[model samples]
Target: MIQATELRLGNYVNLNDGSEHDKIRQISGIEHKIVYTLIKGCRFAQVHQSFDRIYPIPLTEEIIIKCGFERSEYNDYRHPILFGTLTLYEGVAELHISDMYSVWVNNLHQLQNLYFALTGEELEVKI
Candidate 1:
């Protein structure tokens, strides 16, 4: 199992668009999977222009492991599939991953462009 601290920021792409402008807020989970939240309103005008509810985006084990998060840690908290949740904060908006697909590619995109952004060598996602 990979340590959470060992996981560094990697290639992140704004799944909403082809832009690379999403700020990762925090990562939390039990073990095998981790939950990644984005700062509200970090996307381009076009992407945020039509925003409505806030929900968590789930990612697959392949993507999470590839990003350097230890999947074995949260085996107990692992959800079968991707799911989203709507959260309201100070009348603003927030997203939370209630399940795994939240990290997939529905609300946000993978940071494939930022892959090399990490200081270490390229790490490939296991299929």
Candidate 2:
């Protein structure tokens, strides 16, 4: 199950019980209450607030075909992205350092620091 907080505008989910008609709804935000429009049939729509009640619908090829999503619309050139990589080294975990290609970390403190630098969110590390 995917949490509501993790949902993005393009994510699909099942907003109702797992019935045949309840399986493929896209997360259209217009309804504000977490609305989901059906990927099949006449575009049936449903809304719910209890995100826990929803199950994220996986985007299988069949579902994509059913949804009529043109492959060209999902092209990388149409939606450019900037990305980075982070790596961790277990021994002598002390300092955090970075170069143009990657970030290297030696310990838990360094790991948390790198995570914060990249995501702007404090990461809770668990041993």
Candidate 3:
């Protein structure tokens, strides 16, 4: 279960529909501790779901690559705009902004929040 308060618009989360299969969805909106998601399919559908259905997508090598960041590469594109080196150490994601500044991100939403906090822009996530 994921706390709705910890998430923001555009964060990715897994929608647990009580099936073994997990549906990854991007958060479209959040209000009053309720998370709203746009379900993707043959047609775009908006669904207001209970917080119990929302789960944090674990930070992984595949997730980082899906975000357009290259593996084992220092991504410093547009310097002051958005630049960080993402590395997984012992199965944990470490985002190194510089030699001295770094943060441990455990979930997709947490990474989104951190990126937004630093760049003042929504991180484009490829689902």
Candidate 4:
């Protein structure tokens, strides 16, 4: 987790549970009174207040696999797979950054988006 002052424009964050990921589209105000930009269609947007916790999504092989990318496809570097935001969360429940494929994400919502896109379900974790 990080502070509102540390938030970047494209940073991914889970303002709620670890399941729902929203991107920081914009930032305004000052210090603790920061406001976030929100557009239509996203799970969240346009916050007049700052959240107590904003969990940034760490892009890693474990996260990629958890989002559902196959490990077998990562063996090659030159012929790697490139996943767009639309198709990234489908197919498998395990993935990670690979030399062969480029996993693209500019915000936190991509994590939830991937999970939902692949599973046709809301992102959630078992307690």
Leading candidate by TM-score:
3
Q: Model 2: per-residue lDDT, tens digit, 1-127?
A: 5544555454445656645665545555534344454444445454544555566443233332332222332321110111332221223221223243544333233433444566666443211
What are the models' TM-scores?
0.22, 0.33, 0.83, 0.33
Whole-structure CA lDDT of model 4: 0.43
- Model 4: CA > 4 A from native: 17-31, 37-45, 60-127
- Clashing residue pairs, candidate 3? none
Query: What does candidate 4's lDDT look like per residue over 1-127, in tens digits?
Result: 5566555443345454244564433333335555454443555646544565454555444444444444544331110233432223332223333445545554334555554555566544211
Q: Which portions of model 2 miss their true places by more than 4 Å?
A: 18-21, 30-46, 64-127
lDDT of 3: 0.78
Question: How many pairs of residues in model 2 come into backbone collision?
Answer: 2
lDDT of 1: 0.32
Q: How high is the CA lDDT of each candidate model?
A: 0.32, 0.40, 0.78, 0.43
Which is the better candidate, 2 or 3, if ranked by TM-score?
Answer: 3
TM-score of 1: 0.22
CA RMSD of all predictions: 15.8, 13.4, 3.1, 10.6
Give a tens-digit lDDT track for model 3, residues 33-93. Answer: 5788888762467778889889999977777766666654443222234576777755567
How many residue pairs clash in all the candidates, one count each?
25, 2, 0, 16
- Could you give the candidate ranking by lDDT, starting with the highest? 3, 4, 2, 1
Model 1: lowest-lDDT 10 consecutive positions: 45-54
